[model samples]
Each structure stands twice: as structure tokens, then as C-alpha cells.
Target: MITASRVFLIVMGLGFIVLGLNGLLNPLGHLAPYGLDYQAPGWMGEIRANYGGMHIGIGVLTALGAVHYAWRRNALALQLVFLGGLAVGRTLSVFLDGMPPTFALVFIAIEWVGAGLALWFLRSSN
Candidate 1:
């Protein structure tokens, strides 16, 4: 008996898991969208830790939420925080650092929309 909320949580969780795997396995390809490059080992470690480890950790958290009914709210909150944070940073970069590539712009839009949806579901569930 999967409700819409559970489905949403699963989707968000899987999305993060995929992103994390990409970051860990193909660090350069993951950063290619942003035209970011790193030549040093320390930077590679940072990328794997931050982008790879963090996203996977977050993904597991949301996936847990999908599994446990009581965790749904927390999962939604995670989504709100994660996606919202990304949207905010990207939006500020647009204003402060100048226009980013279309790839970033698209992500910004998705993040905002995803954050908004998370919030909506959170409120509706309460």
C-alpha cells in the first residue's frame, strides 16, 4: 500500500543515491556539467567526500523515510533543506557571480520546484 507521499520519498531518495554514485565513481564527469576541474588529490578527496558521500548519506536518510511511516515528515524536511539549499546557493551565484550555464539554471529550477513540492507535501500531511 504505497501512498503518494511514499512514492515521492522513494523518488527523491533514489535521485540522491544516483547523484552520489556518479560523484563517487566519476568525479570529473559529475563536475563536468558545472565546468569545474580539480588537479589536486585533496580536491578529489573533497569532491568524493562532499558530493559523493554527502549525497549518498542524504539519499539513505530519505530512503529510510520512505520505508518507515513515522519518518515521512523528517524525510520531507530533508528534501526541503537539501534542495532548498542548493537552489539558494545557485540563485545567489547567479546574482553575485554572474549568469551560470544553462545546466545550472535548469538545476536551480528543479531544486526550487522540488523544494516547494516537499514543503507542500509536508504541510498536507500534517
Candidate 2:
């Protein structure tokens, strides 16, 4: 039987993979909703390499954790770090730069939830 934690990891991993691929393949479209326009030279490549690569790396790690019991804890830890960092960064942006778009707020919530879930599973497994 698949545990809830494993299920969560798998779902999150796949979601990240899709998001990363989309960003990499279509930087303009992917960023359009976020109010970012890649009109300058090399901006698209920068987004594809940095943002997409980060998400892909995280997604692969998360997926590995779901399939490999030995890597599960470490994977959760990585996720906690990533999601928690994002949440913290977003909070700082909100304070320093003022409120962002609604989508950004939604992402902030998701980041917190992801971090919380990772923390919960990590603690429960101990």
C-alpha cells in the first residue's frame, strides 16, 4: 500500500516537472501570467535555464524520494528547504515591494502548504 507521504511526494514531483517543462519550453507564455515580459535579449534563455532548471532538479529529487525509501527523508528535507525558502522570499518581497498579483499570492500560499506538508511528514517519520 502506498503511504500518504509517498502519494504526496509523487503528486508534487509530477506537478513540478510539468511546471518546469512548461517554463523551459515556453518562457514567454509561462511568465506572461506573472506579468513578466521577456523582451530583452537573452532573458528567455535566462529564465529557461535558471527557473526551469531549479524546478526540474527539485522535481527529480522529489520523485526519487517517492520511489526510494532510503532517500525519502532527505528528499523531504530538500523540499522543506526549497518551499520554506520560497515562502520566506515571497513574504519579504511583499513587505519590501508591496503586494503582488493574485497569482503570486496563490503561489505564496502553495509554497507555505508545501513546506508545512514536508515538515509534518518529516516529523511524523521520526
Candidate 3:
């Protein structure tokens, strides 16, 4: 019986997978309404062209990891790296380069809270 928390995490993870893939896959225009500067990074021009698949994969794994956390809490550790990475990336985005108010802030907050919860869930097995 998956509780509300599990469902929330699953859905949240699934959302990221879809959003990230869309941004990476559809580079013709702004995939995120708030806008993502894929070119902000070093060698972005070289990377962005071929990075959509990676984003999609991350998104898929994020949702799967959340489910793994819900069903098998121990597996949350596997995703900790990703959650931590996301937090760092967003922090860098906000600090080094300017980010829009809408999606960027939301992503940062989600990454922070999600990472914290993932850590807590992994620590306690009750």
C-alpha cells in the first residue's frame, strides 16, 4: 500500500523526468517556461546538442528512484548523488549566472527539499 508520501515522491520524480527530457529533446525553443540557459555552461554549445538523452535518462531514473525509495527505502542512497548534484547545479545557476524567478527557483527548492527527504528516508528504516 503506497502511502501519500510515496505517491508524492513518485509523481514528483516522474515530473522531473518528463520536464528534463522535454528541455533536452526540444531545443528549438524554450522548453521550460522560465527558460533554461543550456549555453551557460562551459562547452555548452557542444554539449547541449547531444544532451537531451541524458536529461531524459535522469528524469526516468529520478522517478524510478523515488519509487525505489518508497518501495525499497535503501535504494534512495543511489539517487542521493543526483539529488545533491541537482542542488549544486541550481545553486550555481542562481549564483554564477542569473536565473529566472519561476522555474529556476522552484527547481532549487525542490532539489533541496527532495535531497533532504531522501537523506532522512534513507537514514530511518521505520
How high is each candidate's TM-score? Answer: 0.95, 0.94, 0.62
Q: Cα miss at 39, model 2 (Å)?
A: 3.4
lDDT of 3: 0.61
lDDT of 3 by residue, 1-126 (tens): 875446545765676566556556565344445454455555354344344555556556655655665544533553566667889898987778886587668877887887777777666646
Clashes of each: 0, 0, 1
The alpha-carbon lDDT assigned to residue 16 of candidate 3 equals: 59
- Alpha-carbon lDDT, every model: 0.91, 0.90, 0.61
Candidate number of the best lDDT = 1
Instruction: After superposing candidate 1 on the true structure, give the runs of residues whose Cα lies further than 4 Å from its correct spot.
Output: none
Q: Kindly list the per-residue Cα lDDT of model 1 for residues 2-79, writing each as its tens digit.
A: 988788889989989999999988898899988899858998998888889999999999999999988889999999
Candidate 2 segments exceeding 4 Å error: none
Candidate 2 local distance difference test against the native: 0.90
